[model samples]
Target: MTGLDPELADATGKMLTQAVAEVVGDDPPVEVEESVVLGNAAEVLLERSCGAELLVVGSRGHGGFSGALLGSVGQHCVQHARCPVVVVRGSVS
Candidate 1:
């Protein structure tokens, strides 16, 4: 949806499903649902955060400074989300 190529979107969806399955395994402790929504990433996440228990985001630190801890979207969510927010970063090897 939203300008994404059909094949790419299908592949992305499948990949996300597989990743979630791998994480949750056969019997997840909590309910799990997978969906794909195309829009401004931050705006979409904020809208969906209305009643979420927690919000988790990944930051590649690809913003202005390479050594920065959070990207713009993660920072925005941390400041504005109604629920608790967690920012996950790549492991320091």
Candidate 2:
């Protein structure tokens, strides 16, 4: 998974991990790394997808814009990711 913003990455990772645990009934090992792309989620996915089996990213991001469409990073990854990508949507419940 690509996480460009540290704060967003942390929060999302925690939520994802929790959801997985709830569904699977076990806490698996999950590593949330901070990519070097900083503010660019596309660049981070491009770099991380070299040998990755799947690319997972949020549909929206930590930007000021909020609408019904996907964010810039989500759009770019959908078009450019080497492998299959999963774009998770909705806010944490």
Against the true structure, whose lDDT is highest?
1
Tens-digit lDDT string for candidate 2 (32-93): 34333445557878768777777777765455555535677777887888888887776756
Candidate 1 structure quality by residue, lDDT tens digits, 1-93: 778889989999999899889878989998776767788888988887898887888887555774466877888888899889888776557
Candidate 2 structure, TM-score to reference: 0.52
Candidates' C-alpha lDDT:
0.81, 0.67
- Model 1 scores a TM of 0.75
**Which candidate gets the maximum TM-score versus the true structure?**
1
Candidate 1, clashing residue pairs? none
List residue ranges in candidate 1 displaced over 4 A.
Answer: 61-67, 91-93
Candidate 2 error regions (>4 Å): 1-26, 29-39, 61-68
Q: In model 1, where is the ten-residue run with the lowest total lDDT?
A: 60-69
